[model samples]
Target: MRRSLRLLAACTIVALVCCGCGTIAVRKTSNVLDYLYPEGSPAIPARDVTLTLPLRVGVAFAPGGTATRRGASDWVNATAMGGEVTEAQKLALLERIAEAFRDRDYIASVDPIPSLYLAPGGSFDNLDQLAQAMGLNVVVLLSYDQAQFNETTNWSITYWTLVGAYVVKGENNQTQTFVDAAVYDIPSRALLFRTAGSDVRGGRSTPVESPEAFRAESAKSFEEAIDDLIRNLADGLKVFGEEATTGRVRGQGTPEIEVKAAPGYSGVAKFENGRYSGALGPVELGLVGLLVVAGLARRRSA
Candidate 1:
């Protein structure tokens, strides 16, 4: 009977705290969520409508990674955790891109089971198998480059769940905050699409070692990274998406993309001398700055 009273008190405390705190948390998350990643469907070329039919757009995800063990680069490896990513964040990004193409009205509905690229000797190794199953003519494979760093986390102790442990505190710590991103074509095993997109990394302190701290840290980390990725993805999809589709169709020779940058960012191109000159636009850089600031502020508050 005594043990039950303690349990009830702990629950009551947590519930009260959450009632006061949860609303702000939810609001910040909802706003931040939009910036996580920004992607959209590619636009079909205006000149080539007569010769071809609308193609199916498929997303093929590959194994992801972070820069360091401190969780400073969490963005790099968040997606592959299978169940770790939020439905809203993941589906929102995919939908934006899918809708981009759907707006073209030439594209059919986006496929549900998007393809995935596996490590060597994994279950789904064959490209042909994926292409066949997806019934896809075009596929987008996104990649990540470590963007942010920092792993020092904050802790607010709360009651513990054990029989005697009381008032366990929650800690916010950082581990990996990497920023890596790219898009590729699945069929022909060719690199049809790519993006320098948004590369912003949040520096988390250290991951909180306790279970509660770890859970909160993980969820918040995932949320922040997902938000940044979505914003940048959206920008890239809008700009290069259509052009990438165009290039895949008829662009056989080396090409260069002329891009106007926002302001101070070093707008670097990949290929030179009439090779593959990929142009990154203003929208991506702007979004990167916005998310980076938000992540830093959140880390400080936590």
Candidate 2:
């Protein structure tokens, strides 16, 4: 009987040890390619692009296969396990992006669009509809991918004691996030430029606290990645402007660009071939000419 008891105890211990060595992983992603080309890749035709000055722009997040809203507990569970981005979060992020372009002279307005308006794999046709409805000439789409993994360390064996589950740091957790922004001209269906950012974070946590810890870390990672993306986007805009001015961007029959003043804009501005000139209006020009002629007459009399 003693030997049998000892054998049973050993088996129980081994089973518990095996059970402690488990892992959990979750992934959530919104891919632009998947949203734009659901059926398959289609050949895109090149077309001319006319860029009106003071462009009306819209920004939005790409839709993925997930619910847009959830309860508090559901949100905690979802975020802890790398679930989809919520609608509220998307709006907040889009607002931040809009601020980046709001002050630019070339942009008339930057509007935040909700993901609900777009369907996955909607392609250019969907964009065309949205552009028309919103009076937007350009659109910026944001997509993201996030993953979280949790695994038991060798020290996890202590979790069997119950108290150790709360006090022992035996869970290894890692979170990785990536975000991308693609700018497109709505009329021509042309991809003007794109920028991206990514981040990875890792830490150890007690088994009981892993869920909350993972959630916090995941949010932090996304914030950091977005900051990086904004910096890169600024650089990309500068480079694109330079290229457009040099005529290099117009190569390969990409798109023919024409710049014209927006309606209701009274200030005289001339933009040709991606270059801006003639800042003065006709009225100002006339005054300057009059001053020059008057000065010339005075010099002759002297």
Candidate 3:
């Protein structure tokens, strides 16, 4: 009698689980998340400084460094191009950076430096010369790196139960891309701000198949990462512009130039309670749904 009862209980539990386990078809998806790294400490103020602009802002690439060259390998490896960004994408990113500066009420106009000017490994003298020639008081030096990696994931029998009984097992391919950016004030030649962002998307084809295949498959992820990085850069610039224009300068011997740390997880990119304040997309929804279903399963079993 006890054996029959146990069998009945087992069947009842399976029925409940099966009823809840519908098809969980996780389709191909793209998701980008921007992260402003946390600040270490407050900079020591040499004195105070202020910026009043009819600010001429331009974006130029930073000169190659050991790290920069290594990062740019992603581009070289994928497209046989020495640069990480294509010429068109470079121009677009520059214009976007300039526009961020233009949005400030104190700034009159912003322009892109037509030539790819390197700052001699970020030397202030070299930057000063470049700024003067361009008639720019502020130069936004942007160095970018984009990398895509792919891996295949398999769905097991346990996952099949949640997805649906008829769900077939197969490999789902995914690719991830990254972008990094930095901003500087030319007059002071201070590193004003820096930020980085990345995105992951499921692509139709494997990125490693060939250069063309990699580019085609990962283009969306790359674009999304760039856009998010630009937005983060713009947000940080807005705050710095406000502070420089309004904040008081003190002990005016020679104001020490210090680059303020990027405001991490602040402003519109509100990362509160471990989730973005923006609308939850499919990626986020999928995660939450999985968690909820798992909890339900636990309760039912108990």
Candidate 4:
């Protein structure tokens, strides 16, 4: 009986040591630079850009790291263990972003583009094709980087006992996420503006529950970061509008870009020389006509 007890004690010690001996780290990311300028920046002659009002816009997630270069469809499967961002999640997030621009006076429509439509490291030519196919004048690309680390805490020693692995909160998880949005004029290939957001979260879970807990934490971190991105994006949009209107967007020497209503759009607004020109709408025009007739009748009576 004494020898048996000693052997069991030694086994427990080895199990406890093994439980806390290793750390697990996972990383997943999508990079806009890799997707848009994979061959490095190319030199092209500068030309003035003409922005037609009521612009059609497209939004999409950029392809992830080189491992996913096989195509975006492979991303989920390849990074499954790392808690890959799902297509459904991407669509929902894109819809929220589209809603932000959909009601703008200068925007006609905002479409959420699927990652499948984009090739990894396809560059500007890919965007050109997408724009032509989708009738998009402007495009917004979203990219993200996330890292998660799992470590055993001091409480992990309890995991030496089989039941403790299921009941003791011994695993510590840390997740960090960052997301970015870049707006571009497809025709001109000019970067109009950009915005970004990030978040970090930490929690402890029982060893048996660590996988689920880590995934949940990662998802929550992404949602929080995106919320922040939206707020910052709104501010960036405002600044871009102000700069574009004042002719300061591309600097002084650059020719002012013309802005006009699309061929069939009925809105009576125009932009010339970097200034907004508001014209009377039908209701306003009718009111002015009534006032003119009233004045003429009063003059004849006098």
TM-score of each model, in listed order: 0.41, 0.74, 0.50, 0.74
Show model 1 residue runs off by greater than 4 Å: 1-53, 64-106, 112-125, 143-172, 179-181, 196-209, 241-302
Give the Cα lDDT of each candidate: 0.39, 0.74, 0.48, 0.75
Which segments of model 2 are wrong by more than 4 Å? Answer: 1-21, 65-82, 248-253, 263-302
Tell me model 3's lDDT, rounded to 2 decimals: 0.48
Per-residue lDDT of 1-302 in model 3, one digit per residue for the tens? 99999998997676545433322121122111111111343342322333433446666654442211212211114222123445565576567666645555444467776434643333556667777787776666554444444222232223335442224322233456566665555565345556766777664332123344445545566567767877777666556544444332221343443323232422222211122366778999899999999999999999
Reference-based TM-score, model 2: 0.74
Clashes of each: 67, 1, 0, 0
lDDT of 1 by residue, 83-149 (tens): 3334454445455555544544334446533323333222223545656766665555444322222
Question: Sorted by lDDT, highest first, which candidate order results?
Answer: 4, 2, 3, 1
By summed lDDT, the worst window of 10 consecutive residues in model 3 runs over: 29-38
lDDT of 4 by residue, 1-302 (tens): 99999999998777666666556667768888888877666754335667787889999999754222121111012233345678787888788888866766667889999888999888788999999999999899999988877777667767656687789887777888899999878888777778998999999888677767867887788889888898888778767766677654455765455666777886534321233578779999999999999999999999
Candidate 3 deviant stretches above 4 angstroms: 1-48, 65-83, 99-104, 119-122, 152-175, 206-210, 245-302
